[model samples]
Target chain A: MTLEIETGGVQLSTPILPASGTFGWGTELKNLVDYSALGAVVTKGISLHPRKGNPQPRLLEVPCGLINSIGLQNPGVDAFIQNYEKELSALSMPVIVNIFGESPQEYAEVATKLSNCHWVSGLEINLSCPNVHAGGLEFGSNITGVRDVIQAVRNSTNKPLWAKFSHSTHLFHLVEAALEAGSNAVVLLNTLPALAINIKSKQPVLGARRGGLSGPPLKYVALRDVFDVYSRFKCHIVGVGGIIKPEDAVEFILAGARAVEIGTGAMVHPELFIKCRNFMSEYLKNGSYESVENMVGLAHDDQHV
Target chain B: MRDSPTHFQLTITGNEKVGDRFFLLSFENPGVSFRPGQFAMVAISGEPYPLLRRPFAVSRTPEGTLQILYRVVGTGTRLMSYWKKGRKVNVIFPLGNGFEKIQNACILVGGGSGVASMIALARELHSRGTPYLLCVGTKKSGELDPHSSVFQNPPLNVKFATEDGSFGFHGTVLDLAEQHIHSFTCAAVCGPPAMMTAFLERFPDVNAMFSLENHMGCGTGVCLGCAIETRNGMMRVCVDGPVFPGKILLPEHLK
Candidate 1:
């Protein structure tokens, strides 16, 4: 009677979750969002150690999207688990921990620490960190490095693993490597590389020469990616791109995404997730669709479970 | 430091001035507060060019609203002009820090839209009951106030100047402030770079603070994208300031 989709052995109350880096340790937005409400809460991309991350001017606002090079600044995994583990345990919804590491060992080390924490539901292996120079996007692109990271983390933790893939021409290869290394799900398309310039100051806007672009600008591109991979592989598709409205969320669901992540729209609208969730509820009620699962790949017409 | 996607619906259509191409935007949210010499990064929300935001100094703080002055230069401005009555804009604001508090008698100098920020300072001074003089210059005083009806009780001793003798004195801000530089305890200036530099040169002894507009990523300091050359060293304008005192920067920086 209701739309219920199972992912990594858990049931999502909805089909929307905040993307990493957009949402902080959950307390910053304690006033805006309730953890019990979302389909799931993806924690900010956490690394092996506390990182000061990038210097000033890390975000650039485009027409409908924003470009960010935050450098994945977070208290390393040890500190993260120590700090967030208890808080995450209190949440009624699935708590996904997004982990970033310099090397395979660091990845495994952090995963192992979180493995023992009962509150952690799954791990999103960050194969893509655009701000750092070493083992950054390079790690996500190389087949051996990608597989090694997925395999190493998989070997270390029993928690369901979701390997995130960067959006590029060769994304299929990265997906292949992740699946080969045995990941439960894959997150398509990190921000595409972008930058800005100050004509008055005559300099590049982002301190980093390049950054990842997100928001409405990348909406169709992300859908194309989801369609590309979904058309090729029936594996779970987590759609992410320029989703600012409820209709946008519906579009992703129809395009074969079991769930969607809101990134750029979150920056422009902090309470966007809560708003999107409510609007989607209306979308579900007014239509013939009884549950979230019914709309999961509705675009393919004739294909309804 | 907490970023939210909240935007302000500024009624900027009727407020264009001689040099005011951009309208400064601020939230009407009661709790929202900002000081003089501070600015907001505003994009027309859907403008094609200048996809990013441009910085403008806060010009004034009306009873419940805030304002900034800017010139229409690129596509962002032309598109911004078309903004309807309730058009809400995406803004990253109260960004960087404002000018230091002025104690004793203060002298304020503004050139065109740069005069925009000093208005907020003037209001702060008014609220604090501090004595101040506001020397503003433009081509015509007509552009001084599109909302002139609101300023019957002003905060500072105001004077005006015009380039073609359209209104006030027929001279630049530096030429006018030359005789009165030492009269005030502090000087805060925001305007065309040339005029700001001239003010800086004239009042070498007065404590002078300036706000430099830089292209920024985040209004916070984490991104070193808004870099400015200072006597002490290079610092991010977004973090270090949109405001810095005269002594901290070299003369060449403006050049």
Candidate 2:
């Protein structure tokens, strides 16, 4: 079945993309996955300056999820362009640059530099990374803050703008603000903020004391947020969080997401991209759906079929 | 560089106790050959309680059993201790750069549980007809008991040292190696940081290879969790060299 999707003027061959951070710079998994079958490859958050990230014990395992406070570590935008641009250009697939900054101007600066590079297809403004101490989730938790960042980035470049929002209480308001500020689509949901403790040591498990939760525990919350935003605005959504199986991707699409991004699922299974595609192909044929796009918003209609 | 590693589920053959607080967990060998110091990232549990996989050095018995000698230190290793026969665990194999060929007579010094990796190296060198001396060290004699299968039928000259004078030598393994430093042309040391540091200081100009240990996440180049500041630059312990040259490793005191 044709899984083609048009988001921000870029045509995706399939709706399966690996989430930022989980896929590294896309070169690390080049030998593992079939890149031509993928919609796009989103890179880790690139900031204005290189960061050392958090200390040891940066990740902890909970019951059904992972808690991480990696603190948005990257080699900065200039180094990324100089070092990874040549390799990313050879991917033969759409490359979404996930950009982050301490302020709206910094976000624009990153976007502006990326706009000059011919390899990048879209820009995923990372205003919702909950693990960092500043600038990330802070800009995503409010409506005006979201609009300000998106507007600054929008003014800087003509590239496809995807505002990646968090699973915050004010997420709907933030989504509306992103659309108003000229976002072509919204990447619904970053990891949820959470904490874990080591009883023996009586201390926080993560190095940064708290972290963003991902995996099975985050699936329902992300789906609800996608459904809530999609039912109201009818905007394109790139659903993320705990898409381990093809059934989970189907759940997200039925909830009104046009595409799905695999994060922790890829970490647990490196061959997840091929597995998800195989399952989706079989799913589409068995369900008698002409294409993956036909399955979108199935849950929003009056009839179950 | 080698080809991309395949992640597979291998069933446990047995979890036999080889030493005090140490277990030799064997699994069905996937028929892939690996170097002496290379390791695998083994999942402790399929669930998320221990989300990240734990890295272990690859060891094989004389009977052609692929095994890992692990000590119960943390929750992950402790959970690995309880794994039973017939249980399947996911592992990504043949990771990190292993040791290179030893041209001349070599001395293998292993401190504490570091000796687990030495067993594999010893087996490989013996099969290749390389001359080497094996030195195993621990806190006391009980830590390296005679009942352990790892101590059986060692092909080369084997030496031992203990802190309490209960074994071959009366001091640390580095102290025991001092006498034989001039006899061997090369050395390979794997143990606690202090032991490696002392060995480096004693034989500054001698050629030596070291197997390192660190906390790892992906056991690949991605997570960057196992980064070590080397003499050259920031190097990942997982992908760069879990087995590094003596000169490349930054001294512990300087770190």
User: Which candidate leads in DockQ?
Assistant: 2
Model 2: CA > 4 A from native: A129-137, A197-203, A301-305, B1-3, B9-12, B44-50, B61-64, B74-79, B82-89, B104-113, B129-131, B139-147, B151-157, B162-187, B192-208, B246-255
Alpha-carbon TM-score of each model against the true structure: 0.72, 0.88
Top lDDT prediction, candidate number? 2
Top model number, TM-score = 2
Candidate 2 per-residue C-alpha lDDT over A238-279 given as tens digits, one digit per residue, 9 for 90 to 100:
999987666888799889888889887777666778777777
Ten residues in sequence with the least summed lDDT for candidate 2 chain A: A128-137
* Each prediction's whole-model lDDT (CA): 0.69, 0.81
Write one digit per residue (lDDT tens) for candidate 1, span B1-255. Answer: 323322454444344333334344433443356667667767556433344556666544546555655556666667665655455566655666786667788878887766766777887787788887777777765656533422333435677777777777778766666657667888878777677777767677788788666555434443344555578766557657777888887666653
Tell me the interface RMSD of every candidate, in Å: 6.4, 2.8
lDDT of 2: 0.81
**For candidate 1, what's the RMSD?**
6.0
Residue-level lDDT of model 2, residues B10-102, one tens digit each, is: 989999887678898889988777888999888777665566678889877777788888888878888899999999989888888888866
